[model samples]
Target: MTADTSVRFREFKMPDVGEGLTEAEILSWYVKPGDTVTDGQVVCEVETAKAAVELPIPYDGVVHELRFGEGTTVDVGTSIITIDVAPGSGPAEEPAAAEPPAASVPTPTAPAEEAEEEKPKGRQPVLVGYGVAESSTKRRPRKQAAPAPEQSAAAAIQAEMNGHGAAPAAPEDRPRPLAKPPVRKLAKDLGIDLATVTPTGPDGIITREDVHAAAAPAPAPAAEAVPAPAPAPEAVPVTAGARETRVPIKGVRKATAAAMVGSAFTAPHVTEFVTVDVTRTMKLVEELKADKDMAGLRVNPLLLIAKALLVAIRRNPEVNAAWDEAAQEIVLKHYVNLGIAAATPRGLIVPNIKDAHDKTLPELASALGDLVATAREGKTTPAAMQGGTVTITNVGVFGVDTGTPILNPGESAILAVGAIKLQPWVHKGKIKPRQVTTLALSFDHRLVDGELGSKVLADIAAVLEQPKRLITWA
Candidate 1:
């Protein structure tokens, strides 16, 4: 019986899907209790701070329990699901099939001291080579003793009369507003006090929507004493809800915010702008589209812009480096990981092409096409985003002039490509309509001085102005 019990149940913990990700929100569950799953069958899909990933179960069995519901951000090494390895092998398991034992369930509501004492000190198993990680164990905030019974009853009655029967607990008596990890993080990002939010979720739980609503500014009160006349026909009705919509900052967006903040404050930025006539480059794009080598590839002005930036980096290699604060050294990289900033429904993500300096024009186009497609599909991996040395952002696609782009964390420089439009310019002799665009290059001043930065920007503009430079530069 002991041996049978040992092999009867198996627990699957959330794996670190990305590099050192401490937690992940379970976006969806593919399996539920009593569902049969085979080894390697995907059981759930989770969104980490980096990207959305599907998790596959390792053991084949009947799904016995789901520890956390969908949308819960579970810590790494915590068991998310249990499987009955041997579903019907014993009579002892028959009575327990309907309900899992209390011992198997985690007591998150337990007192902090009791929880600390009860939790196992031994390290939990993780994927091989990942080693054991300290669980992001959150201790529930202690609740203060309730007020006198009479006061509590009166408060409850008063609350009931107000429609939302749930009485607001005393400041000290309020347990941590019942919220998931992601919701808590969102509240922190938005500078909202969760205790002040009125929870509408079932069972008095604070949700992301609650936090977002709290972050939204309240409507201004009317000052007039008398009734005001209705507005004219052209006037649009305005309300706080209709005027603005709030989106919870989490996952990739949250990460991007933190990264941009760090990069902006830490690095001294120097921006240089130049206007160039890209009529030649635009014609080259059409030529490339017709070429057999570039067929089936995404041939666009951005492709040439990316190539131009890479060529500029090759010419001014010193600009393609990072400032290491710890060692107080400028780490110059020989290979360029060209990051293309792509905006998605989730948020902005920069999944880079590795060793971009080594790829030919056609090869570069293919890589860019694949990267953009994968990012749009939300399949970009964390590995693809790491080790980026330089980046390019095309604001031209949005039909806007160039703006100074913020550098990606740990990268040296970022180039912004503005919209190419027909403008009158002094060509070889006369002023005629020409395809012109503005380019803005922003780099870390600590590593790249004005001359080097100017040179790099000039080279990119020069390449775009003359498409034949690609062959000469190579």
Candidate 2:
């Protein structure tokens, strides 16, 4: 007896990489069909709304199929790749193309009387001899033949696959429009039926632009003879292909834009600004950079600024709270997940440190270092960005003054630190050159009133101004 050597195909689906994320875009594929892959090997990178994540193939196999192409956005749980686990054992195509033998196929040549006897009775074919006994509740009678549309579609496809020309199907019985799932979704969203969209893609498939063209309104009747309007800047066409470039917003940028927009509108934001003399804090940063305790850690004004903000939150605990609209409650958090906004090539991502309020100065500095490093490398996880109680965005690094930073969605407040510069200030008695910077604190008005917001801003300013408040205030 011959030992069975059959190919087994295993499909890898798009995973929900981020909490509640529904889809991800395939950024690039590291391997193509016929490439051998080992278990836990990174096969491709996908960019979800949160971040770019590398997906590892879970089993050793030869890649048999890549279901979607790169740049295609696929829904979670949909199979993106198929692997032939038993690659060399048998021919991969045999199993997929195998069909029942001719002898088993119901013969059309059977006599009418015999065919009638072979026809299923009231049972209507369930698991062999497992169907219900006849009763008043009648099942719909099965059709003797396949639906006309389905039969036409199958015939046309079969003809094409067999390398034979098929008689053109009637318009009414035309095969369902040829488009990928995403294109179909786009057509549906635009309220344009795929059947009505003209096909401009290879092999008579409907492209995205075809759908858009169908959705475009017909030109106004030429009889209305209106005077030609002056061409607008955007309306003028350029020949050099350098006038404007369009970038498709997806992945992190798209998510950040939506979240920022929602935060701006949903949260009643109240921003407070304060200019502070951070000459002492700047000196402390240099001292800390040299200190053995802070050795090898990123010791900068931003670090001290973060510490100042944490201290401010500690002194004004009421500012560390969230508004639960559904619960209609003000939830005060005991622990703070301090967020530091980092600008990456992808977009601005705010990955927070867990329990930052409990960490020592050195520990906080280390955490900040890791957070910024990971964010810069585009390796920050979604969990690190979630559950943030407050955020600090340092615009100073960009040589800008303070900005009214938007709250990071669910977080209560965001502190914006401005560029530190040497300016003449009225120190003690006379004007003296001092390192001064401006700070802007934006908070959800419903959670933090003007007084509470002011106190938080003031505490942060005092901590930066004195640098000793970190010890005494703590």
Candidate 3:
């Protein structure tokens, strides 16, 4: 390939999808070698620790090579694909174009020097997959080495093992076992060896299940001294078939687990619970459902419960704060990023409504509806899940009483709403069947004292008890 050639190739590196995320697992590839792709076209989908994000190709090009296959967890800065940005660059000519000229052919200087000469002058605009800091260093073209007979045989075996078109490793070293970063991390955590575990995934890849199976304890030996040559009884499997399934904690679930553990141990937690008659709140839910402003939006008991929590935060703004352990200070937030805990097939994810304190009742309801819909579809972006000041988890949907929920990391408080049931209660000096529910507020004791926590819970309960308080409180 001559440096003066007009055709140019660009390498697209994996980007950090989430804030400072180290790696992401490629879920699927939308394009392959030889396929034509346009700028801003989604080339692949990747699942980070927080959420699944689709990556768009930043420039128009014909795909030349996909460096990594689907299911591979690539680091943020590693190049994953090559694109021929120059028009009229045919797929068949890609290999020849990438190859250096013969030694006998005349050239001005070395390939690296030629690339340096061809490098664009001055500062270049940062491309989508490229990092902020641009490097002018040019890479020399790699020379193809002839393989020995033994190496050729080993390469064939390695290729078969990888199943997909991953390049084989060096002949002296065994090919690294194929597993996603999360699965590899799980193996490392359990001290299980990937080489020993049998792979069941496509292309002989180790899966999370394979790692767990390797971690399971072996059956104990019989204690009895058996007489010579007696036929051993057929060993019974310890685990019942399809009775129980073990899912490896990863992605959203793994992130939630880590955050919960950090919050539980780092911050001293204090929980306060209260049972309130929310008959008025339920009646208002029905009223709002019929109202013109709330039309075509999700108006439910949880919506009112969320609004009540917001009102309580407004009344007790001190509780809407976070503990800054690093800085040794308490950070009070004026605006509320209200998180609503959602349980999906992936796991528990809390996608918050940004600036919930600034939104009206109808606007809040619309945001809540959109948040729930996005979460249910597993399309919630990582940005929507960050910077939360407080969270409300409605356990009522599962027909359960309130739980002393753990505080979301960086947030001071979380409110749990229990199931609303009809119970006989004293109302206006007489026993009456009214809608009642329990509320539990858990907060970081370092930032919120028991008095403040109790006040916040009481405020929420009061708002629910008298729906008119929402109007007056605002």
Candidate 4:
């Protein structure tokens, strides 16, 4: 009897995943209620902390309910899915081979009350850290018991999850099905029954291809009997018009569209540009890369510029706050989600450091390196893509003079760094060679007025104009 006799259930809640993030939007569910999903299964993908992450189930069981729908922003610790384990199962134990209901269950009423009481009181009930309080006691042994009404109706539940009549078609055992909107839509449009589709993806996932094929019209049934009656003019012509074409918005295009729309709509943008003598800043970049303490750190011009911006942000925290419309208030944060505008094949994305204000120069350097690498690989999770207080768009890498880059959505400000070029300059009232670059600062005039914006911009230029002040960083 080492077998887990209790019918283990997985109350799969949303995880914060990083830096005390409290809420996430449900992008999609990979599993539905009454689905027989396995342990470590990706039951849903949630967009949290700016990244889209797949949540894995810790218990193997039949899903009982989908707590939320797509696009719903659920707080941490909210149960998105509930699982009901078969008898003779613990969290991950293999269910007994087709055994009848022979077990003991504690009186359901008390347990529900106790579970409700155990739920933490808060705005977001993220239950990841708290272990199952009830799992502390093992089930007491009992005689073979008759099926309860709930258990008897399990088949009815499964059929609903399958999205059809109760066991109308008992197809041979196959991988369980996902009951998402897209999946259901696909099944309906194709006239293909969901129960008949075999899932080949993780934890029995029915992929987009499966839906596509299912939606494809079945071949004509051998011209159907003696007389076809001209097939009613090919039944209104099955295909679209000759010039018609359909393209789904997904992957890089989808991400790009979303970013542009968000940035354009959320941030009230205003752009300002200033040419600067960055001679010292360029020289210091070379010197820091050679320093013993900074060895192995990826040194780029952006490092010094970032340091400059951070220092300036400390002087002007107003630029790093968010506008709360419903509350009719401006929320100022002590920490910074510093967004670095990255241009990739997927388009322009502004992923930020969670608390960039807390890191040293070395840590910041490492963070920048990792951000650049991850963005290039398209592996930047949805969590990395949010809560940006302000953004820095480095157009210098593309060898441009300067441009008024649009503000990232949800951000009030963006600074564009231009290319550094050797040019003639006047120092000590004389003409000489100097490293020149332009700095552009764009801010929402409503949240950040000209005075504050100009001061921050000037502070950044001053740091570049004289690079030694970085020694006294906040």
Give me the candidate number with maximum lDDT.
1
Model 4 stretches astray by more than 4 angstroms? 1-38, 41-248, 255-267, 472-474
* lDDT tens digits, residue span 88-159, model 2: 443423223132221111211111110011111222111111111121111235469755674454464344
- Put down candidate 1 lDDT per residue, 1-474, tens digits, no spaces: 332333345567778877688988777778778788875576877788887776767565678778887657878867788776555443323212223332232322211111110111222333321222222112234447655566554454343223232434344543355564446667776778888999986447676668768988743222213212212113344576696655567788899999999999999998999999999999999988999988888899989999999899999999999999999999999999999999987789999998899988888988898788888777676767888999998888999998989999899999988999999999999999999999999999999999999999999999999989998996
**After aligning candidate 3 to the native by TM-score, how far in Å is the CA of 358 from where it should be?**
1.1
TM-score of 4: 0.56
Residues 356-457 of candidate 4 have per-residue lDDT tens digits of: 888888878877887877776544655467677877888889999899877766677889999999999998799999999999998877688888899889
Tell me the RMSD of model 1 versus the true structure.
20.4
Weakest 10 consecutive residues, lDDT, candidate 4? 113-122
Please say which candidate is ahead in lDDT: 2 or 4: 2
lDDT of each: 0.73, 0.72, 0.71, 0.63
Roughly what TM-score does model 3 have, to 2 decimal places?
0.70
TM-score of each: 0.69, 0.69, 0.70, 0.56
